[model samples]
Each structure stands twice: as structure tokens, then as C-alpha cells.
Target: MKKLFMPYRGAALQLKNHVVMAPMTRSRAIGNVPNELMAIYYKQRSGAGLIITEGTSPSPEGLGYPRIPGIFTDAQIEGWKGVTSSVHEGGSKIFLQLMHTGRIAHSSNLPEGHQVVGFSAVKAAGEIYTDNGMLEYSAPVALDEAGIARIIDDHVKAAENAIAAGFDGVELHGAHGYLLEQSLNPYVNNREDNYGGSIENRRRMAMEIVQKITASIGADKVGLRISPFLTSNDMPSYEEAAVHETYVQLAREVNRLGIAYLHISNNPGIPEKTHQDIREAFANTIIYCNGFTAETAEEKLQDGSADLVAFGRSFLANPDFMERIEKNSPLNELDYNTLYSPGEKGYTDYPELNYISSITS
Candidate 1:
């Protein structure tokens, strides 16, 4: 519909359309720094209304996956400058996703002095892919009061670094079993202190990070992604009632703080009414993401439930995804093998529809 193509003006983000390119980990940031190749990859897909980058660690301990980008070091910030500038030149707003992997990590992925850490001293179930191969996740050290402070400080610094790197804003990765979500999960956060126990206490770390980051970079420039039902990376699913109660409270509190947007990862079990409830709770923008087709996204927009729709695989495989949807052109198949492998083979090699047609003709 025409609504999906209409410009969306948020508190901090002004996009040319409502199609959002979801944050997806491509694992191409060689040596944990954003590079020119990453710039070219994002630049190629600048047709999206907004681009939320791949998961980028905020600190050394947050490095759970090999080759994932970071914003802590000066070199990382300088490296991201090229990415931000390229995307901007292509006429799209981009947000840097700040992700901390928590217990879902191996020591080899971390810096020499840094060890894996999380809300509790729990070890995640599955193995993580390292440079060597599949390595089992190690039990993380529980964060002390000082460690908690450091994590919050690192998040704020990462947000500042993203701004310095020319990003339009920063999106705190609070979902998909990352550090923030780990703290929110009742199964993972079994601590006896203020950060554990009731839903309010369990949700404290994420709340504090959002508040602190908003303090450092204004609430208008801060966004958060949440998945209350995600079971990946040892995240446990809470009961339906508990999930609604916990996340609705989170939505309300963050809405009071006036955040730019709340990015929701919608799954099967989570009801549509729940999305509507969160939409009502938040004041600014709500981006619903997860296996969405253009038709369904337009329907959601028409129903007034979501302001934007974020596509992950579609945008990844189709560099001109918006254009393809507009013209009803066929989409390219995703190569799962190269999704995490290094180099530009599948990273920046996905061709635009027009380019392919020109060559064929």
C-alpha cells in the first residue's frame, strides 16, 4: 500500500519509508572491527527505509561470537565511520545495534584478560562457533555490583562511540538471549540481589542501561529490541501471563522515558493482541519484525498495529528488497552456508534486481 512507502518521522529518525532492514549477524567484521566491505554491503541495501546493523559488542567480555564487530576501541569507531557515511550518502538512516552476548560465549572469543560474564553463574546449553570450530559455552562469572556498573558504563560508552562513528542512533540489543535479555529471563537470572527475583528486579539491568544510555545520548536517539519468548542461547520462555506482565511494564516504563522506538521480534506463541498492547503502551514508534512479507507488513500498517516492519532474510538476500516488492520481482534464495562464513562471497555479492535484468537483457 501507499502507506508503507510514506515517510515516517520519529523523535530522532526520519525515514523515507516504513520498510526496516532488521539487525542480522553476518559475522563478516574481520578482527572485530567494521570494515570497507561491511560498508559496501550496507550501502548496497540503502533502499531500505532504515537499517539496523548486525550485532556489535560493547565491551571485550561481550564478544561471544568470532568476527562480530565492536564499538569500544577507537579503531572500531573509525572503521564504522565508513559504514555510516556510506549508508547516509545512499540516503538511509542507520542505527548501530549494541549487543552483549553474556553467558553465551567462549573465552577464545573474548579478549585475553576478559572472561565470560552474565546475570548468574549459569552455563548456556549449546556450543558456540569459534575460530577453531564448535566450542561449548563456558560458565560465566556472576556480575558483582562493580561489574554491573561496568556493563552499564560500557553500554553508554558504546552508544557514544556509535554517535562518534556517524550513526544516526543506537539500538540496544535487549533481545535474543543477549546480556540484557539474559538478565530479564527468570531461568537465567537466579541471583539473590536486587537484579534478580521478581519481574521488576529481573528487568532492572536493561532498564538501567536504557536510562543511562538515554542520559548520555538523549532518549530520542535510543531504541531497544526485545523478544520475551526467544529460546535461543539458553533463554527460557516465561509463561504467557508473565511474559505480558513483564514486557508490558517494560514498554510502559521505557515509553515514559520517551525512547525513539521499541523493536519487537514477533513469534508464533506471542499473540497479535500482545503486539497491539505494546503499541498502545509505547508513544513513539513500534517496529514488528520476524518473517514478514510485504503484504502482511502492509496489512499490519493498515490495521494501525505497527508503524514499521523489519525484514531479515528478505533484505539480506535481496539488496533491493523494497524495489523487488514494489515491482513484484522475484527474490534471490539465501545461501545458508555463507551466512556466517567470512569474506564477501555471500556478504556483498547478492545482486540487485535491475543489475541482473540488465545483464540478462
Candidate 2:
């Protein structure tokens, strides 16, 4: 069998295949809670070995996007229970991704009393979509020592909640210029305290969160996703050497903690040496995501670059993604419209191979 279709047994994850479903935000969670529609959506695409859920806020303050789900409340946890149960019934492991959109947020998206907070008070130079249409990002309240402590505690509790909700594990959203990645960027984090200044200081918040979460929940049930050079969400480019060192150091520390995996959000800006360095430093499973077809993903697995590969748009468009790959069938094109709109039109209405065959016959 091909490496991509072969079962993977490592890092305490025994997956049915090496293919993983990358997390993509589909704003179908009405009232900021998962529902039966979301459960059906996941169950349809459970052909992948592992599914990392969409960005779920760990607290009320982290709900920076309109309609994104949260795991902080009892209702949210109960909602996610249905989704996890469905995924498990389909014979796939699922992980809840805890993402806190820090400076990359507008006040209109947050709850009544919660305000946007981040490592520093600097606002990201971009507009986020809200119910009131595109709005400028609100100025974040720079977190003091107490605020930072609270953020860490929130993550720990979120991870615990994920396990309670029937998740196989939890993945920390340390990539994509979210709250954790906000601290890594020096241009955004201008604090003079211990959590700022040097490379060690810049990575302190993320490292502390990983360490604490691993302590609270076993290291085997945790994964961290990171993008070293991809400057999404108004993140400015810094010194090249500093960027390389920051992630390499991070890989080493996480390796020491013995986490389940390190998910690298692959991009063109990331140098080959950095990839090699990260692979050498971290001995656990490493998943490479973004812009991969089955052929390329299979090559990545065979070439020893990645133990597993994740597909975002492919799974989003094709529910039986693994089946299509196995049969060498053409994939359905993704509809640009309704990517984040409510309802099941472009979300769960995608046809499977059987449906296509029936129509043609």
C-alpha cells in the first residue's frame, strides 16, 4: 500500500491512514456553539485518520470571529460532544483546536463584557469580517502578568474540556497570527517585561502554554501548530535569523516536553534549512499542511519529510477524500461562495463518488 494510505502508528496516535483533515473555519456554528449540522459535516469527512477541528475559542474573550464556536461554556462543550461522538463513530480520531484571535479582532465579534486582549496594545493593520460587515481591528488591552496567567489557565481548562467532550486530544493554535503567535512576533509584542525582548522572551507565552497544557493533559494528547515565516493576519516580517532561531528553539523545547506532534503550516517563505532543522530537533510526528494533493502528499510521506499530511480544501470539497484518492478519482471543485455563510448549501451538500456515479449511470 502507498505510504499515505498506510496506517500510522507513532506518538501515541494509531491512525487508520496517514491522511489528516486540516482545520478550516466554517462559520456554521450558530450562536457560537456546535450543532447537529456540524456533526454530520464531520462524520461525512471522517475518512481521514485524524481531524483537527476548526478554531474554537478557549474563552469568551477569544471569540474574535463572528459565529466561531467556543469550548469555554457548558453549552459549547455539550454542543461539541455531538460532533466528537459522530467523528468517533466513523472511526477517526479528532482534536479540538484552541485558537484565541488576539489583536486580529473587532469588538463587535466578542461577547457583551469580554474585550479583545493580546500580548501588547498594538493593533493589527487589517479589518476582520463581522455581523456589521468589515470593521477595523479594535485596539487590544496589553496583558499584564495576571492577564497572561489567566490566558494559560484558560487553555488548560479548555484542554480538559476537550477530553471531557470526547476528543482524542487537543491541538493548540500557535500559528496564523493568533494570540499565541502574536507573542512570537516582536513587531506586535513591544513589551519590555520578561515575556518580551529576546528570542526566549518572545516565545515564553507559547512555551508556557504548551508546558502547562501538557502537564494538565498528558503530552501524548497534545499537538502544536506553528507557521514560522508566513505573515498572515497583519504580522510583519522581522529579522530572518531571528525568525529561524525562534522556531528552532521552540521545536527543541516542545521535543523535550514529548508532545504528540508539531504541525508545520508549510509555506513558500519558509527556508529549506529551517525545515531540516525543525525535523532534526523534534523527534515526534510532524504534520505538513497547506497546498497538497494526494500525489504530492504521498511523495512527502515517502521522502521522509512528513509522517502525515493534512488537506484543507480537498476535504472541504470532497467528503470521501481518502476514497477519491485511493480510487484516483477527480475531486470536486471548491465553491468560493458560502465558504463561511450559514446553512448547508456549500458546506455539507457536496456530492460523494457514489452520487456522481449514480447521476452518470
Give the Å error, residue 76, model 2.
Answer: 1.2
Q: Which regions of candidate 2 fall more than 4 Å away from where they truly are? A: none
Q: Could you tell me every candidate's TM-score relative to the true structure? A: 0.97, 0.98
TM-score of 2: 0.98
Q: lDDT score of model 2?
A: 0.93
Backbone collisions counted per model: 0, 0
lDDT, residue 306, model 1: 86
Clashing pairs in 1: none
Q: Taking the tens digit of each residue's C-alpha lDDT, what string does model 1 give over 1-361?
A: 4778889887667899998999999999888998999999999999888999999999989989889999999999999999999999989999999999999899998878989998899889989988798989988999997899999999999999999999989999988888999888888999988899999998898999999999888998899999867787778777888888888999999999999999999877677667767878898999999978988999988988888989999988889888898998899999998888999998899888778989999
* Local distance difference test, each candidate: 0.90, 0.93
Candidate 2, position 163, lDDT:
92
- Using TM-score, give the best candidate's number: 2
Compute the lDDT for candidate 1. 0.90
Candidate RMSDs in Å, in order, are 1.2, 0.9
